[model samples]
Target: MLYRPKFDDLYRTYTRAFHLEVQDSYGVASENEQLQRFLGGEPTTYPEDWQQWDAFVKEVTDAGASIQRLRVVTEPHSDYTRFLLHHTDRNVAAGEYVRYLPRQNVSSDAYTVDDWWLFDDAVLAFSIFTPDGEWAGGAITEDPVLVGRCVEVRDQLWPLGIEFETYLRGQG
Candidate 1:
């Protein structure tokens, strides 16, 4: 069986990590409550898990490494996507570079790729989601061809993504 390292392990080991998120809504159990709160017009406080992730990002970036994420979202964002947009400033404050691109802007071929995280431009970790958008698990590979393609996609999309604040302002 191929070994799948935990996300924390991958983040700690790689100096440069880039994430591409394509889902409009994710069914992460941990975030369901918060999403509901947002949808109901209640204030959604940052949960402990989010705080922990922010701290981790701060630590990694402080050590001279980098963590960047590009979210490809549909226009007229889904409820979950709006929830994410509302909270992304916390991620930015903690040293993660977050950007967004409208789904229409992506090429057909690029849009077919699943969400993934590339580490040090060497390893590729695919985020596997069920048809309903629930987190299933992930697969990690070091195959050069796969990694190269992910790298290429990252390079292609990164330039097109608008910075988080800019994108958020346009939404308002």
Candidate 2:
């Protein structure tokens, strides 16, 4: 089945959700206002639903499930990446473990190349996106080998990712 990112059903169905984000920019509608603010040198603001989302994350983590993300970023980061970096603290505070891995630091032979989520280490949700960075849709599969590859990629890269706080401080 296909599931949109941030679908409520995801939290209810999976014990853990881990994401790998490889893009430098995402042109999602939700980021429009914030992106403009960021480019205009205004102070960063949390998304409108941030509080509700934070509460949801807290509920999930408090229940012993987890939400972790590893982003592969380019050095001399893109504006969008800087925006994301500035706001990562909010995500961390909300109970998601966020990490950053420099693109140059990742081995080219990595098993999982595209953006995806490994839900409970069982479902591999491959994100399909347009060239302009807009979300097209996503595909989810439970094939054991495919799932195992994603699990392996997570295992290999997650440890190499820098903690959000550390990455933020070093951005200076």
Candidate 3:
């Protein structure tokens, strides 16, 4: 999932948490334990080279490249759908690096990480899977048009800077 060309610029590289490149640890992720579930066996499988995918994410974190995160798109009434925005927002606040994408034109499809199509258009899709086949997902988009819009949103959030806490307070 991570090896796709769409993810090239997003992830840096790696050699002991820095971009050095190696044989075994090519596509490993450095974010945290959550990424482990994404790499687990079946029910959730991907067409791309998982090794390359790991390398890509590891590189990105090592290089300090910005990551754009989107909450899972879902039906407005669905419980998962309702949790999407808040989940994405909370993850970002933790500095794990994420962005809540704009709503999609399509309706929710109930696709899980096991569904390859979910990560099909993804620039970089790295995640963890639970035994029940649920995925702790983090998808990155490299679509030029979408990237531009995401940057705009990030810019709006950037002004809050060290004072984002106060800004969030006001919004509350």
Candidate 4:
């Protein structure tokens, strides 16, 4: 969640990618809603200007990257829906190109937002997994099984949005 950019010494080198898995529980929901309320609808403006989601959307859109969203819920929806709807609006408001796919499935396990720290890329990616066990602490790679499991979960959801070039075309 932290980084140092580079060159102009602006510390914008936050080439971090984030991946997290979600589970059918209230833990993540409560925390996420709390965060939204705490930030007072400025979810994309926290931390700093570089942390601004507009910057992220611009970077990816200008470079022509794909944004795929996978839904793990069925008939009923969850709080995560807010993320999709709001961010989609965010992209359009900024005139950024973004393609999103919504899918339904059944996945096991939950994770903390901290799980997204594994991400680091120019085309920055986020693989979110709802973590178990009381939302673990800071980024800790000491546990590979948990890390590997998160990656495995993401692979299953990747195909839902494979046509990057084609997906970008639909974006304005």
Candidate 5:
């Protein structure tokens, strides 16, 4: 069996982490309640996981490390995506740099790449999800070829992403 390190472990060890998110909707079990609340017009509350993540981001960023996420989303936004957008300010405030890119702006070939996190531009952790968008598992690699490709992808897409605040304002 292959070893899968916890994300917290990875985050702590890496000074720079870049995340590429391509999903319009994610069926994360922990977010189901929050999603329902958002859909029902209830006030937002941070989940434990979200709080912990925010704290981690703050810690790393304050130490001079950086965490950035670029979400490539379809236009007309899925409900789940909207939910994420609504809460993105919290992430930004916690010191994460979040951005959004319209899927239409990218070549179709971009869709072939799975969501992943590149750590210190050396390690790649691919996030696996089931067809229904539920989290499945992760595949981590340090192969130079694969890591190099991911670095190339990041370089290509990073400039294309609009800051989260700017994108959200334009959505109105």
Candidate 6:
């Protein structure tokens, strides 16, 4: 059924975990420290939580599960995007395959919205967020039609995305 599982458990439970990110920014309360540090111009630190997340990614990937994310960002980028770019290195280091696609490059006619996670080509969890970027909840489902759509969307746009490092370098 549809349910919110622990982040680490996502990797453990599914053979493939795919995430699509459409937001220019997120105002998750848990990310406040990192955001503040980023805004303050402090050097990035690998905090304990960061390390744990990294470990989870590595463990999952090492165990042969794929963890991937596709982030669609607008060109000229938002401040939050820059912050996210800075932190993306950690995501890569942790063994997740991260990519970026410029908003202009993406054909809007193909997709209506963003922010969803697909697990094993079955479960789909559409994320909801406040206008201010605060984390809300997800609308989860397991309908085959929706699952097919998620797979199609992932296939169509994922290859068009630039790999994490390549995207950052191009931004410079």
**Of the candidates shown, which would achieve the greatest TM-score relative to the real structure?**
1
As a whole number from 0 to 100, the lDDT of residue 27 in candidate 4 is 46
lDDT per residue, candidate 2, 1-172, as tens digits? 4644455567668899999998888876777798899999987678766667788888888888889999999888998898889888888998999999998998867745689878898788888877767666667788999899889889999999999999888887
Which 10-residue span in candidate 3 carries the lowest summed lDDT? Answer: 15-24
What stretches of model 2 exceed 4 Å from their correct place? 4-7, 49-52, 130-137
Model 5: what TM-score? Answer: 0.90
lDDT for model 1 comes to 0.86
Q: Which pairs clash in model 6?
A: none
In model 1, the worst 10-residue window by lDDT is 1-10
Provide the lowest-lDDT 10-residue window in model 2.
1-10
After superposition on all C-alphas, the RMSD of every candidate to the true structure, in Å, is 2.2, 2.3, 12.9, 8.6, 2.1, 2.4
> TM-scores, in order shown?
0.90, 0.88, 0.30, 0.40, 0.90, 0.86
Each candidate: how many clashes? 0, 0, 19, 24, 0, 0
lDDT of 4 by residue, 10-109 (tens): 1133332333334333344434544466447554432233246567645654554433333343224344444443334554544333333333333334
TM-score of 3: 0.30
lDDT of 1 by residue, 1-172 (tens): 1233366678878899999998887777788899899999999998677898899889889988899999999988899899999999999999999999998987758744588889999988888776766656668899999999889889998999999999988987
Candidate lDDT (C-alpha), each: 0.86, 0.84, 0.33, 0.39, 0.86, 0.83
Preferred candidate (lDDT higher): 3 or 5: 5
Worst 10 residues of 6 by lDDT: 1-10
lDDT tens readout by residue for model 3, 1-172: 3443533533443111111000111122332232333334213222234345445554554565444333333223233233222233343443334322223432223212221111222232334344544343435445766444434433443332323233234334
Residues 18-38 of candidate 5: C-alpha lDDT, one tens digit per residue? 999997888888888999999
Where's the lowest-lDDT run of ten residues in candidate 5?
1-10
Q: Quick one: RMSD of model 1?
A: 2.2
Question: Which model, 5 or 6, shows the larger TM-score?
Answer: 5
